[model samples]
Target: MDLFDCQIIPVPLTAERQSHISFWPNWLPRERADALLERSIAEIPWRKDSIRIVGKTIPIPRLQQWFGDPKTSYTYSNIRLQAVTFPEWMDTLRESVERETEERFNRALVNYYRDGSDSVDWHADDEPELGFEPLIASLSLGAERVFQLRHNLTKQRLAISLPHGSLLLMGAGIQGHWQHRVAKSKAVHSARVNFTFRYMNGR
Candidate 1:
């Protein structure tokens, strides 16, 4: 889709403050998106990472990998991910995203949801390493899913249906005041992959 086709959704943060989300429902054409989805599932080295919760080790429902400068690492929920240099295909995708969004992104956290049961819990991408008011560009491939967001203070919420090849940008300041998650669904049986592009300091 062209840049002018973007859908901007306003997110109210407070009485005076507001953030916004830019969504492109058809960022990539179906044929290309289908090929990418197949390549991602078959070629990428997906990792099975677990988190420690209340002294118990539990495997995360989804598989993920971090790609960026090899020197940079990301840690969240007690799981540390050492950065892997982006492969040629992924780097090309990143560059395309940069051009489309007109934003700089140096890192990507790619997640593979094998089925409906695979999901991510509500959380904010507010790590110190990301600096303040970070912009996140998320690209979805494969099955459609509901991306849910909730205000941290006011408890207000929003949900967006992310379809295959869609792109969504979480604007600045939203991370500080809101959390998002991809919840599990009983009816969805297909797989999905998401690439969350982010910028980091000292990249």
Candidate 2:
């Protein structure tokens, strides 16, 4: 598949100016996407993610792994994630995303939601290390899920069904205006993997 040859459609999820997001429902071919999903499940070292709340440690609903330059470290939800070298396949994928988006992304945060119960809460990617007006590229694989976005002030919400092999690009000013999350559902029995690429301040 040609990484740059995608049918990207603009999504008007928010009315705020300069807050843009685009979605490509079929960014990748089905066979290749399936193969990548299987390979990721087998080769990627996924770890159970946890968060610290009120001095108590609790496991998050999903598994995650960080890959990038060794010096690329991130802090979120009071947890620090040290970056590890990306595998050969991931490096190639990251390069494709960079070429397609024309954005320099230094790190990829891979999240695996095992079954329907695993999910992420509503939050913005406005970490101090991400710098001002960060651009994020999110790729979804495996099972489909509901991705929700909500305006911070208006409380307006938008729910999107994210399918396998889909790509969503969240542009500048989005984190400042909206919060997003992958809502959980009891009906989904399979797993879903998401790769979110971001540019950091120092690495």
Candidate 3:
């Protein structure tokens, strides 16, 4: 996709605060995206991590892996993910994302949604380890999904249909004031893989 083919979406954080999201509907060609999706499903060492809730342990709906400096670890919802060294292919993809977005990313959290039943609940990437006002660049491959966001105070909501090969950048401060999620839908039967690239200090 052309670098100019980006959509900037304004998100209201508060009466006096605002942020934006940058999205590219066709960040990668269909054929390339297809190949990447297949390869990722086959090659990545996916983990079925579970979380404890209400004194019971339940597996997350999707599989995931964390990639970055092995010295650093990320924890959220009581699940601690130790960083795995980035493989060559993922590093190359990260470089490409940085080039397109003009943002530095040293870590990535990859999620694999097997089908319609796999979903993520609303949450903010506001972990203290991520620092304040973290920026996230999320790339989607394979099936399309609806990415929804909701304001913290006003409860206002917005949804975007993310197509295969699309890239969406959650700008600074958005995570601080809004929460987002990929909800389940029976209409989506195919698989999808999302790569959310982020930067960590001291990495």
Give candidates' CA RMSD values in order. 1.5, 2.8, 1.5
- Return the TM-score for candidate 3, rounded to 2 decimals: 0.97
- lDDT: which is higher, 1 or 2? 1
Sorted by lDDT (best first), the order is 1, 3, 2
| Model 3 Cα lDDT, one tens digit per residue, 33-57 | 9988999999989999999999999
Worst 10 residues of 1 by lDDT: 1-10
Each model's lDDT comes to 0.94, 0.85, 0.93
Poorly placed runs, candidate 3 (over 4 Å): 1-4
Q: Please identify which of the two predictions, 2 or 3, would achieve the higher lDDT against the true structure.
A: 3
User: For candidate 2, lDDT tens digit of each residue in 1-42?
Assistant: 454444444434356454567777888889989998999999
State how far residue 36 of model 1 sits from its true place (Å). Answer: 0.9
Model 3: how far residue 64 lies from native, Å: 0.3
Q: Candidate 1 overall Cα lDDT vs. reference?
A: 0.94
